[model samples]
Target chain A: MAALNYIRSNEKKLKVIKSNSITFDNDTKPMAQHQLQPENWVDLYADYLFNYAIGRISDSEVAKDLVQETFMAGLKSAKNYKGDAAERTWLIAILKRKVIDYYRKINSNKGKAEVRMNYSAQSDAEGDWLEEQVADPFSSFENSNIENEELGLAIQDCISKLPKKQALVFTMKTIQGISTEDICNELDINPSNLWVMIHRARTALMDCLNQNWF
Target chain B: MISCEKAAIICNKAQYREATFIEKLKLRFHLLMCKTCSKATKKNTQLTSLCDKANLHSLTENDKLKMKEILQEKD
Candidate 1:
């Protein structure tokens, strides 16, 4: 792009861009490239890895197990560490694989039988969602002055009620803000199935909130 | 111009930043003329924020310590 080329050609602008792009924990200070310290790995990255795993899988115990497994794998494979990415980034990559493996194992054991919802039931002959069904009384609920704690719990309750596939897609896409391509690849779902799953998840949440909160 | 049903699908795609540029333009035009769809779109955005605010937590400190011991044992 012209803007990229312009920034590249301008020495001062390039320096500013490079400095701003250095995303370290401290302000503008690049991460220290230290050797992999296995002892400090838990203190340094346990919370981050835990949160990442918990977000993907709803079970806290399972998340803990996955993070522990990631650390173990990290320790065993420490010799292969190239120090290319940030330590946190490398740890996160390992945790992600552990999560994928968890899902793969669970699905295989369950025979990949997913709870499928009839999408057509939500719509009419004209393809519009049935008006009676899509009652969004609290359209302004997000921006309203409602207590976030209560709202958050209510939302979590709603999510916990959804089917496994819908919940996974919804959590990954809407909550985690992961890319569709990555979510699809991770879940072994196609683009259309991803959209359908998202649609069902949202509809379920909407209905759940309407019934309970609104 | 897209139908309300198509617009609704596109709106979800837009929420995920999966909508193409042309799809985005079409959705914008549809939203201007369609109140119901606009409401649905707004609710969709709110759903995301609410979940984010609820902010599901990770393992507790004790759990982390237990897991750390497990990792150490595996090492």
Candidate 2:
């Protein structure tokens, strides 16, 4: 615990393991450590971010892009990596916003098909959950409790079906164990609105699981 | 409406084992008077437990590699 008390000109002071071999870091710059080792950020937080991206973008490629984008953006602004929160939470907060940005961009693409995904019916997010033609894969859950196996599949499927934004909210709050406030900051939603979206997502997913998984 | 929402709330909380005495009371009272709500509540509880026990994540190897590359890539 005995070390040199280094006072960062950034005004935050913490312990430093001082040595005679210390070379003066010429840069009066901030966030040098994180910027120099961006890979370490992902090495530490990639699984968390990747799961989140899958829930939101639903495409491995796009999710990859978003995670990369989140990391790149954070690196460029490492000055903002203030130690006020856990670095994982802070990095994830960045990724959540990235997900919302993707959702908003896609929600406006006029030429895209109006789609309802059935996670149980197909692996792709746009596999079409039309009322006709497709033979609803999860219809078997209606008025019946699940026997086994099917129940588990149904839950996974319902989570997959959740829309990008709502799913992000629900996943961060429930799946990844991020705080709702962090979710709100990342998603740019108010507390009540976030709750409603989360509730609706949960309700819909629960209904889907009830009808399909159980 | 009250019966369904009340039961849903109680049932939802009960799923997390966070239902208050009054929540239990509402669910019980509603169940005593309405068979449909009672059935729905029972199913909700059962289904919620099933969900809590289910493994929602099933990431593939590609998923992990993509994640690793994302994390390790220089910002």
Candidate 3:
């Protein structure tokens, strides 16, 4: 009878182990599932999305509007978010569309004529000739614009690769130009600590950008 | 003479225009003798200009608050 009871308890222990493993699996499942947090969106993603839009559009007012619209569109379509991408990635995708739509709208409106005129004004030697009015393939302005955009994106990419606190400190000081005291107060760090973070961030950023930018 | 590490700190502060006049003088003196620190300073300055050229801008606190309000109202 004692041997029989021992076997019964071992079986019970096996069942308990199996159940524990199942619970562990469930605990980890939600971590893999991304959830939208709209309340934190502004604080977390506004700057990032703004930088992205401004890099492409070069207008603060329009970039701000695009970021706002992207948030609205994100909220409206939050139900359809499949959690396949991170929250920032998803918001950026929406912002990209808003930027394209803005350009399309301008292209289809009276602004198109102004743009064409501006292009023609640059190549005055051609003097109103229809074929010559087209944008010069080798225009320095166009080339620089493309280069600047690529450089901007590359800088943003490097910033994103920094550790979270470093990225926050670097962006606030370098990009946003927030005062050191304000940054210290906002982040609840001492002045020296803030400086340390800034130093480390600058070092890491330079190293990262040197690989691609310099 | 400040150590290379301290010079690096001052160099970073100068990049943000926060280094004091004395600190700036010290950093400059240090850079004059130290090749590595001077190279780092040059790259650091270049990085600052690149950032400026990028024209990266973020929403102001008021703008962020407005965004939050808009999101809350829509939600």
lDDT by residue for model 2 (A1-214), tens: 1122112211221112232113125223444332334655544455456656665565877887787787778777777665544566577788889988888787787657367665566565454456445666555453132223334444545765778677666656655556657777877888668656755776787688655532
Question: Any residue pairs clashing in model 3, and if so which?
Answer: none
To one decimal, what is the Cα RMSD in angstroms of model 2 from the true structure? Answer: 21.3
Question: What is the DockQ for all candidates, taken in turn?
Answer: 0.24, 0.15, 0.52
* Model 1: per-residue Cα lDDT at residue A14: 60
* CA displacement after TM-score superposition, residue A191 of candidate 3 (Å): 3.9
Candidate 2 - CAPRI tier?
A: incorrect
Whole-model alpha-carbon lDDT for candidate 3: 0.83
- Kindly state the fnat score of candidate 3: 0.85
Candidate 1 per-residue lDDT, tens place, A1-214, comes to: 5455345347545655775566443433435554688877775566557667766787988988888888888889998987656677798899889989988888875546576676566344564457745848646563342345445555665766788578767766766677888888887989888887788889889999876555
Better of 1 and 2 by DockQ: 1
Q: For each of the candidates, give the backbone clash count.
A: 0, 3, 0
Which 10-residue span in candidate 3 chain A carries the lowest summed lDDT? A115-124
Q: Report the C-alpha lDDT of model 3 over A42-151, residue by residue, as the tens digit.
A: 87777778888987888899999999999999999999998866798899999989999998888886756463335544555655577764777655676566557667
- iRMSD value for model 2: 7.0
| Winning candidate number (DockQ) | 3
lDDT of 2 by residue, B3-70 (tens): 56657656655655656787788788778888887776676666556655543344343554675565
Off by over 4 Å in 3: A1-40, A56-58, A82-89, A103-139, A161-166, A178-190, A211-214, B72-75
